[model samples]
Target: MEQIQRSNWKFNMILLGMVLLLIVSIIYSITLGSADISMKDVYQILFAKITGNNALLEGFEKGWIDIVWLIRLPRILLAVFAGIALSLSGAVMQAIVNNPLADPYILGISSGASLGATLAILLGVGISFGPNYVGISAFIGALSVSFLVLLFGSSSSRADVSRLLLVGIALSSLCSAISSIIVFAANNRNGMMTLNFWLLGSLSAANWQIVKILAPIVIVISIFFCFQSRILNLMLVGDEAAVTLGQENHIYRIVYIILAAILIGFIVYACGIIGFVGLVVPHIARLLVGVNHKRMIPITILFGGLFLLWADILSRMIIKGVEIPIGVIVSIVGAPFFLYLVIQNSGERRQ
Candidate 1:
């Protein structure tokens, strides 16, 4: 009992530490950019906005107000929510499919979104949402593909993890091939280049509108996933074991898949396709808290946000004036970091 209590206490401390770190990281990220804003000014701007105090803003130039409030804060907040959505979804996906190598995109969400965005860009085909209709199209494509994948996977009484994975892979390849065809047939070099960049992912389009649309959904879904830790843990134990315990996993698996699909769809729409956060952040979270979903879910959420926060900072500042796509930054860093974690874990096992 004492040991159990000690473990609980330890996890609590770590979770609290992560929450503090994430808050600090978000604030720090907002202060970065070519504009040379200080932490003090950022805070003051935020305080003024939050409190509706015009007096607090009198000392700052109008340009500073626009830079801080209109640009940086929304971008940073978007990064936070985007990170949370991918990482939390990744953790849930790995558990649902019972594959350590699984990621949110492994289920064809990325390819579907890519196809949708490609069509919107190349053929001028999409639902009219705004200036950036590509993202909406991507959202539609991602959800459509996920629905098909689920239909195939659940054709049996229960969704077989292996079968579901195969189905996702197949559909993903089909989407990618179709997207490639569209790109090939379109002779517009500029549109193709734009499509290429969008696929690499970026937060350059971040704004108050996108953040407002994304934040509440990510928050609500994350909270829902946190409460499903019990079923998620049971997932890692395989179907027969869960059935023996009187829990039917098919319904749970289907529901989880649909919700995860919705979450990833929104994330892809918000930022083109920030890839690695979903694949590796959950593993890193597992290292910190072990495999218990109760603990892993929260850590994954914070770590995802923290990881992307730093990645976005690096993305913008890495080149003096030119900003690299955030997806490029994530892949470059995440590949090495994930490899290091794998090596270290393997070495420890050897001991």
Candidate 2:
């Protein structure tokens, strides 16, 4: 009991530290970008907005107010939520599939979303959904592919890891081929450029509307997963062991995959396909928390938020005037870390 208490205390401390770090990171990140704003003014504006005291805005310029409240805050909040959603989903995917390399995009969801967005941009498909129709189309496409993967991957025996991965790869290749055909056939160069940018990912489209839609979904789903931590832990032990423990791993796996697909669809719709946070952040969290979902989930969420927040900052500041795509930035960082993980895992196996 005393040891359990000590462990709980340590966990609480880590949680507290991460929350504080996130707050600081958000404040610091808001101060970056093309427009110059000091830390003091940033806090003042935030304080005024929170307290509903117009007096605090007395000396602050209107443009600064718009920049801080309208532009940067939404973008930062989106980054925070997106990071949480993607990382949480990634961790869940790895557990469900029993693969260390599994990520939210591993099921071809991102490629499907890209294809939907490509068609929407190049051929004006799904325009009836209004201005954000591309996002809606992408969501539909992602969800569709997720269901297809499950359907095709399942067999009379079971939906094993190898079968699921094979289905995902096959679907991914098909989607990529269709997307290439659309890109080549399109007459509008500008539309193709826009589609390309969206494919690479950007948080520049971040706005209050998106934050409103994304935050609750991420928070609620994350809380739900926390309740399923025991099952997730069981899944890591493989299907046979999970069955012996009176848990049906296949059913839970399907549920988790569908939920993960929903999360990925929303994320792709909101911010396109920002990768690596889902893949890398969970692994990093496991290193610190030892693969227990209860501990790893919250830590992964916090670390993912912090990671992408900084990545977004770098995306803006990397070039003199051009913003690098967040996807590109994440890939640049994630690929090397992935290689290191592969090497480490291989060494462990040899030992």
- Local accuracy by lDDT, each model: 0.82, 0.84
Per-model TM-score versus the true fold: 0.88, 0.91
**lDDT (10s digit) by residue, model 2, range 1-351:** 998898889888888999999999998888887887888888899889979998999988999998999899999999899888889888998897777776756678777877787778788899999987877788778778877877887777555667877888789789878987788777667866766675688898888988988888889888899899999999999878988989888778778877787677778878888877788999988887778899999999899899898889899888968899999999999888877877886888799
Winning candidate number (TM-score): 2
Judged by lDDT against the true structure, how good is candidate 2? 0.84
In terms of lDDT, model 1 sits at 0.82
Cα lDDT tens digits for candidate 1, 18-126:
9999988887777788987788988898899989998999889999999999899888998889899889888888887786656766677777877887888788886
Task: Please give the range of 10 consecutive residues that has the lowest summed lDDT in model 2.
Answer: 153-162
